[model samples]
Target: MTNEQKALITATVPVLKENGVLLTKHFYNRMFTHNPELKNMFNMGNQQSGRQQTALAMAVLAYAENIANPSVLIPVVDRIGQKHVSLDIRPEHYIIVGKHLIASIQEVLGDAATPEIVAAWTVAYNQLAGLMAGHETNLYEQQTHKTNGWTGWRPFKVGKKTPESAEITSFYLYPADGGKVAPHQPGQFISIRLFLPQLNLKQARQYSVSSTPGHEYYRISVKREKGANLDTNGMISNQLHDFINENDVVDLTAPAGNFTLAPDIDAPVTLISGGVGITPLLSMLNSLVENDYTHPITWLHGCRDQSVHAFRNQLNDIVKTKDNVKQHVFYNQVTDENREAGVLEGYLDISKVPSLNLQPNAHYFICGPSAFIQKQYHDLVGAGVNKQHIYFEEFGPQLLSLN
Candidate 1:
């Protein structure tokens, strides 16, 4: 809002446009070189995949756009706050990042890096830093004070590994410290941190809690990352599948995420998921069943085959126990003869989605690959679903745009 702030934002626009990628690269390099400890805080694989780079670039642009009207950027700030908390990003780290970032800009701009330019950037950086610091503080405070299943990383030990299919496995996690765990609402995600030996880095990934919140333990179903071929395995997921085992201790950041079940018990709920995207919906369904909510619930899940379908038995059990819950499975590749009889034999046709027992005031939750979510999102919106009522989560870096 200040003239200095306006000047700073104005001066940085051309620089960011011209050398954003280079600045990001240099900034990260400098940051990691100076604070090797931070290497553990970020996803190296995401860095290599160029996801982190793009996210930073986008964030800077967003910040610049909202320089005069920072309030317009609160949602962006809130999301970044959640991510920072999930990653255990602290205020001190911001200072470090800012220093390195300014140095990188100076290194890039050379003689053009006048005192005024540096002062403007300094003010801008301080303003952003204060914003981030406040956001993080509030998040931390909430996590600390909240009684229900919301909190920072808690120690959990693996209880069971139930095989969902060839590529998918479900993990039951119980608190290792014997502390009370908060009950999470359906459709929320928990951030899991793993110290990978091979990569020598602490990597974090968000997994939808597959079980209802009232249970004694948390469950997450993960699909093993089958690389494009033999060349590119999903770094965090594959490592978890291969290395994690029953009784192993894991750290889980509190149940956090905005995607959640509809609060109104009267509103119809439709869950659409693809492959392992079924994790969150399964949790919601279980919650609905446990709480005996009378709202009609339809689960339309798409997978390759029965072999890869997660929670087949559990879903069947729900259909049997809950009159309000219905399930439709689509198998892209069906090999099993007996169980494959009534299963639809292709991907979900988004156009036909609206005809699937949907109610007029239905709320929808969708999770899958970027393409799947995007296609279904368009289809749902096209079918006159209120955009506010539709919630979705994308599996990987491809979903960054949604963030």
Candidate 2:
């Protein structure tokens, strides 16, 4: 962009921050009204809960805040690119979003949005879109060419659905075409789209592949969401739990996510999770077990109680069989058996667990509630673990910045 445009964008950063949500909410409304087809591409549950608007607002403000030096946002951009690819978001969708976004700025900013300002924002939007499109294009090329990989949405049938815990259920999915499935890296997720009868529209949701890779079927463990939180009260989750059934078919994009394990890395690996965040970490742990890995691996988890702890026996079996694997469990409710059996009380306080010693070449992966991930990330850093080795993925829109 020109220097004048850059200066103008920087000058509007405060205004963007103040009215980001208002602008994005308006943008979504305008986009949906004009392009009703997008109703199939976005999570209507997030829209209802206002999470998407808030997240978009923050993203817009962040982009405007760093208009001069976008390189600093490359990591975030790559992360978003992975998600977009998972949802099969194409260049056309970006065009739709851009038009409405620019219009929303004009509408929300009103008299403050002069022609010069609009042109500058147009340049800024295109610049950011170009960066994201480039990253997504590369990702699409790499993924579609990989063995057994396919682009866009593929049909999958629910072979079986088994309840794992009080709130979580595991769904075993087999491709409807009966073709081979790609071996995805542990910790990656797949975007599943289904028709919502209530809204009479299609919506897509991302769920972590909770099973070990290399199997004929891809498994996703979904926790039925309810209550006020957007993560739990998701319409898709409710649809899966209450409406969908075995033998039901759903559409899904290929497995995609940047958060994954490097199986070839000789470093020790530590996996930590809270509540339903265990899904992806479970995939990692199962991969280790399936491969008979000899590396020192530690599994740490926290939940409300034993009844709510999904895969408790599966983890116990690993602890029993894997010589190099160590496990620790923390319960919110302290109990006599929990104490006698070595389970700790409250959250997984990393400082209390010395068994997870800071190995020089160890890598740490965490997934959980935003607050849980943040606290564990800080604790991991405080425990002498290198920040570079710490990797995390939140369940919902990212609310915390590790840097």
Candidate 3:
């Protein structure tokens, strides 16, 4: 954009911050009203929970704040680009989003939004959209070119469903046509698309691969989200839990995500998780045991109690057999039975746990609710673990900052 247009965008930085959420909320409603078919492409669960609106608003504000140095947003864009590829978001979809975004800006601002400001935003939006589209295109190409990988969506059949706990269930998926499946990184997730009969629309969700790679089937464990927020206790998890059964067909995109185990076998590896966030770490843990991770493996987990602790038996077995694996189990509601087995009571406490003492060349991977992940991250950082060695995964929109 010209200097005048850039200046106009910069001038709107305050406006973007003040009304970003309102504008994005308006944009989503307006777009859905005018183009209802696109509803299938979005996560209605996030919409109801206000996560999508908040994330988009923050993204817009950030882009506006960094208009002069768009490169500063490259890391953010790349993370989002990986997600776009998993959802099979195409370049053309950005065209629709840009139109609604600009229209919403004008409608929300009224007379204050002059034509010149709107025109400036048009250029700015195109610039940001072009960058995202280009990144997503490259990700899509990488997925398609990988051996045994397919773009868009490929049909898979549910081969098995095993109950991991009261809340979590594991689905074993295999190609419907008996084709080979790509081997995903230990912590990567694949987007699974399902048709929701209740809503008369389709929805897609990303579930981390919960099993080790090189298996004939891909395993994804899902926690049945409950409660009032349809966005959180939404359609996809419920359908997978209740409706989808063995042999049922679903569409899956190739695995995509950046949260994975760093290739440093000799580093002291720490894997921590709470509740169902253990899904991805399960794969990482399993791989570590399989490869006999060449470092002290500290596995710490927190849960409500034994009843909800999925894979308890398997985890216990790993700790028993692996000399490198040391463990700490924290139960928010512990009984005498758990105490007998040496499980501690209450939530995870990094400072209090003896096992949390700093180790040399340590690397930490944490996954859980955003607050929980943040707590662990901060604690690890405070305990002398370098910020670069910490990796985390949040279930909803990645609004949490690691720095």
Candidate 4:
């Protein structure tokens, strides 16, 4: 970029950081006012709840941070593209967003918005928009490719809903169209979109596939998110728990996620999970068992209690049937008399992980709520695990905690 452009971007950074919320608010207001149709494209509830505001501010700040080195932002761009694809966001919509954003900046900055500033922002917006457009185009093409079995919103019927515990349910989904399903790598997640009748808006969430890839159907184990004390219940998971039923059609995008089991089975694998985080790990374990990958595997799972542990029978079955698999369960607040004895009864301690007889080259995968995932990540790093070998999937946005 030119010096002039760099200066303009640098100047805009403080301006944005100072008035980002206002800019986002104005941009959305102007955009929706001018093109009301876009109201359907965005999550109004999220907007009202300030999530959209925060997301927009974060995106702008990130763009500015990577202005001089756009390549560093590719992963962020791809994630946004995936979310856009899930929401049916289009290229033309980006142009609309760009126009409103520029106008909003001009209006907010007034005299400070000089010709140089305008030109710089114009170039930056176009560059980012081009990236978004191209990435989204590729995502759209990949989704629609016939060979990929990933086209938009395939109908998957709830073939089975097994209540694994009081708080968790395992859903088996089969293609309603009877089309061949694509085999997913273990540890990948599928995007699920549901239309909220009450709100008249669409919402999407990602769920890890709990079953092995070779199955004719996909299975997801969801833990119902009852509000913790005074906290609000998770909207999507609660909806799925209360209203979703057998034979109900769920719209699903093809499995997509960065976390995956390594193809090489030569190295030992350690799978650590907490609560519903076990979903993706279960898929990885099942994959290993079904494919007869001979590498030793250690699976450590921690949950509140036996009553909320999903796939208990299946996991036990795997351990009983496969000599290569080792299972360790840690139950917190276990009260059931029928529960097994000698199970560790507390949260997973990071110090215990290194004692699992893992080799230096062993690959580790962790997934769970943000706090659990972050703690585990820190622990794994502290335990001298190779950063490249440790993978994680967080159930919610992994925002930096201000506190």
Candidate 4 residue lDDT tens string, 7-93: 778778888888888889888889989997766557665566666777788889878867888888887787677667766677788
> Which whole-number lDDT from 0 to 100 does residue 249 have in model 1?
92
Error of 4 at 366 (Å): 1.6
Range of the 10 consecutive residues with the lowest summed lDDT in candidate 3: 226-235
Candidate 2, lDDT over the whole model: 0.87
Alpha-carbon RMSD, each predicted model: 2.9, 1.9, 1.5, 3.5
Clashes of each: 1, 1, 1, 0
Runs with alpha carbons beyond 4 Å of true place in candidate 3: 264-266
Best model per lDDT = 3
The residue ranges of model 1 lying beyond 4 angstroms of the native Cα positions read 14-18, 111-113, 148-153, 228-233, 262-266, 335-341, 357-361, 396-403
Higher-lDDT candidate among 1 and 3? 3
All candidates' TM-scores?
0.89, 0.95, 0.96, 0.86
Best candidate, TM-score-wise? 3
- The full ranking of all candidates by TM-score, starting with the best, is 3, 2, 1, 4
Error of 2 at 185 (Å): 0.7
lDDT of each: 0.77, 0.87, 0.88, 0.78
Show the colliding residue pairs in model 2. Answer: 225-232
TM-score: the better of candidates 1 and 3: 3
Residues 66-99 of candidate 1: C-alpha lDDT, one tens digit per residue: 7887788887787677677766778888888889
